[model samples]
Target chain A: MTNYHGQWLKLSPVAIIYFAVQFVKDVGNNLIYLLPAILVGYNQFSENGLVIISGLSALLLFVAISALLKFYFYQYRLTDGRVQIHSGVFQKNHIDLPFERIQNVRFEQPIFYRPTNHICMLLDTAGSSKLEAKIIALPKGVAESLKQEILSHKTEQVSNAENEQPEAEHEQILNSRSVQDLIIHGLASNRIWIVLGALAPFFNSLSEKFIAGIENLGVDVDALMASSQYAFWQYVLFFLSIAFIVIAFMALISVLGSVITFYDFKLTRSNDRYIRRNGFFTRHEVVMKLSRLQMIVYQQNWLDRVLQRVNLKFEQLGASLDRQSAGTSGGKIMVPSVTQGEANDLAADAWPENKLSAINYHPVSKRLAVRNTLIAFWLLIPLSGVLAYFGNGELAVASITLFILSTAFIILSWKRWGYAIDDNFIYLRKGLIGVNYRCFPIHKVQQTKLSQSWFMRRFKLCSVKLVLACGGQTLPFIKRTTGEKYIDTCLYQVEALRKSWM
Target chain B: MLADKFSNQSIKPDSLAKVSAQQFTPLSRAYVKVNLMCRLVFWLIVVSVLLVLYWQPWFPLPKMVALYLPQLQLAAGLFGLLSSTYGVIADKNKGYAIRQHDFSYRSGVIFKSVVSQPILRIQHVELKHGPVDRHFGLANLEIYSAGGSMHTFAIPGLPEEKARELRSYVLTHSDIAEND
Candidate 1:
């Protein structure tokens, strides 16, 4: 690719659509206030539709004008060593991101814009600030060529310093999930709960809508309620019906959401980077360098265990603080619904020095179960007494059930909690119903802390927390001696390793 | 699975000499005086405000509270002064150990804890001085990592000159390009 250096270029005209979409999103977010204003205006001037229409048109015009102004101001240029972006309507922001500092480059193309051959390119840097440089709606060819140019420069620099030849650009498909696999993943994941929780706020409005629709059909709700002096069994049946409908709705949404987000999910490795492409309406191409990966987490819920599947997530250096940016593939790479063997193979490919097969995890102290059970018992006893005092037999039964289940979980977690440290990597296994096996190079650890609580001090036990660039993980209820040794060894490795953590 | 061939080595806790054996440098003794002065001023202001509220007619006071307000204020002031004095003494015990490869900070009055971070992992260093600290000619040094709630480590009450020197040393030694 030839260099088009120092040319200040505007985004493709199709970026107008992106800006328009952003405008619509902003309007949607302000709907919480806008809806009430419209309602109040309607109440004030009962049948004045024109007033409401004019107000809405005014709002739309404001959004469109602002979006256009933003599009007019945004410009980017590719210089010799850095990509410079000039944006912000009022603040006049300028950002210069060197190619070497770029941790990952991602390309996204919405299905509607595919015919125009336009793509959104995002560049991430390993910094505390969550600012990402994004170029929206660039011609697909231009985006691809520019990405290649920057990446080639980065690879050239790395290879020149290391005095080694760059690897051939041969893409290898590590794993691809089938429709069946997606369905299993959807079932195994907790998306249904999340969707249900999100919908909780709108439940009252949904029910109101339903009742209004019934009333519009001329049903006498009051009379029906008065007539139905339901028996115990009939009430149970009615409640069960509502629950079944809600569960079925949530399940459908969860399945559709997962399928849409992860359709044609494919993981491929090219040189020292792993590229993932997925999603249906909006295609995402995420690139993750092997060196930038901080940890590999193998997670398995009870459903996943039953299905003999695991979800592997590769966390990178920095966390995406903004919830909006989380939608884009930046901070972490997830491979959903893969077999254990495939997960191991991928981990090995990513970090060959760490022998996952040879890991011998030492379990945490057994007394952890006793301590946890005692704490649970103490808390649950009072909770159960309160429920009994309230004369709520159903809630009392539920609380007892929860107490028993938690006791079992505590025991199971105590049995599963373990850690293993080899010369190169540290592996930590923890969970109850869902087990997570997290492993990272010892050298990547930023900090280590050995803490002893009053209870742990009594038992001559301590917990060790390993802080990474992304976050910290704890191995609890270990003998103080072992915890200190692990911390010391990890510290030594972190200091001795010459390679950068990122 | 090679779980059977794993050799588990157990070392005595006391035998681990890395952080324990390293001598730590305590904060400037004047820091205690600074803390004491700040605490006293803060408590004095709080007590004065409370006394004004009790005596002033702007706010309606309950009859019972008005009856014993002066006594209550006296007891509260005494308690505040004593606790602040104790707190200053306790903070004096806080110390930091800077090793060749890492730095450890030990703090706490009742439950002591030692947190160590590899020098290579430090993202940035900051020296901050508040009004009270400026009055005392002291500054606080904060070290942060790439991600977390707040600073990975903070050492309060260092002489301003020493703080600046340490900050420069950290900035010079930290290799940002290696991480990039």
Candidate 2:
């Protein structure tokens, strides 16, 4: 049994690990500059390595002292239905977060703290730009109890006469990802471009080494370059082999990244919330409540379609900031590499009253296709003219190829643009390469905008934009009458519904 | 091809006509004067800075630039003066309407748009007063929602007292239900 101290208590001594990790990160950041200087002046060091030894010792001493000070100063307490935190060395910052305002309470256990039974706690608030409160290191038992206490307090405050329904009483395992699913997810996601971009700096050295290796093999590379009658079939075979090797390397890196990140992804539903646990080295646990969900997006790219898989993202209120910092797949609850049927099941479970099959999507005005194609042609005229003026036949061919691609893209985008509205929900479908199907509850709209530009006005067309708690979605180039009617219906629904959006 | 599942009988084009027919209360007429004064002051500062830079004896005046410096200054001043004047006149068309459950604001001269936000969705309200606005006895009332790049609504050039009353009314009436 643990001693029951007063409300305000210092974190466990195991918190030193947290501070030490932070200190190492800071040193690593500074080492970018310091390491070069030390290496450049390596000749000045003594034969016994006296200077290096002293410098290393001083860095360790600094990290230890700072970690100790930080651990000593940080203090947190639960009082008056709020989490009160006091910290800072010189400025002494204080934060008071009410239980009702807390959006999520996440518990994370680093690999280093596995034996010590300590974990990190983070609290996210509704509208704040950053975490409302964070406890770097606390005992696992204490963290769990604190989470339960805060959640109970929040339920008590929210369960007024209007919302007296019992929260999620039945917990169920919704879905889990397997290693094969993760591999498929990695193949579907196009992260190879990102890895290739990161390797740009080493490309010159790699090519030089490749050339030297070929020379050592006694290959006449310069003679081949100068030869006009080179065998086309041989060249094609060589290029195909090189492409195969590069693609294989990229596929390996992508699979490794996906495996390490989502080693054991599990999703569970408890009461009114969906909890997702993923990641291997740094575990991520995201909790999203049904009442706080703003929108659901079903996305499938060309590769995803080929694999018969879809990615579903559940966006909750105030998740946009996190999404901006951590891509679309981050912050939000994303179920990746799932079959279309499983995705439909999840969406049906989330919104049982709304039938996804009942959506009747209305395509946008065909004039949008004409407008886009005209713009593409106008852009191509200048590009093709410049290429022809430079007397570059190959570039001229490339420009014509680009023109064809743009035309195809415009047609695809036109075919994809559509919107649907039922009594209780709105569905928007869009995209060219990757189709995005967004469904949102009607009452969750915070604001509605109907806009028309000069060209749109002339064409008797307008656009409607809906701003929800998470983010905004726009349906452009719809008939003016249709846009206006949809806007009015949305406004009416928002005013009629008494249910809470958050 | 698969979009024929749902019915579209509930929505009628006439509903849009009715919504547009609803009258909106115009902003205070004195707002035009306040806007004009602010614009004039901003343009005055910009012109004065340009004049001072040109007047510096140590500053090199290139032969090509010196040839058209006066005309350039005159064109800039005229452009600023005309645009500010037009902006004030355009402010006259701005209007807002407060309904039982929602409020709407209409703005813009060339690309007009009307945005509406339900009262229940309002997260908070604020009254901001700038030094120039204070001198003119005017304030701007800003209403914010849970998440958006811009404020839900920001109505500028309201009387300071009126802005305060509206802020309090919104605060008192916006049912403070638990969110998130």
| Listed models, DockQ each | 0.34, 0.38
Clashes of each: 0, 1
Instruction: Mark the regions of model 1 whose C-alpha exceeds 4 Å error after superposition.
Output: A1-3, A32-48, A128-131, A199-231, A320-329, A353-360, A366-416, B1-17, B62-86, B149-151, B172-180
Docking class of 2: acceptable
For candidate 2, report its TM-score.
0.86
Residue pairs with clashing backbones, model 2: A168-A271
Taken over the whole model, the C-alpha lDDT of each candidate is 0.81, 0.79
| Candidate 2 regions with alpha-carbon error over 4 angstroms | A1-5, A26-60, A158-170, A195-224, A227-233, A322-331, A377-404, B1-19, B40-55, B67-71, B149-151, B174-180
For candidate 1, write residues A160-186 as lDDT tens digits. Answer: 988888877889999999988888888
lDDT of 1 at B34: 81
Residue-by-residue lDDT tens digits, candidate 2, A230-257: 7888888889999999898888888878
> How would you encode candidate 2's per-residue C-alpha lDDT over B59-138 as one tens digit per residue?
79888877877777787789889989788767987888777666778877767787877777888888998898898898
DockQ of 1: 0.34
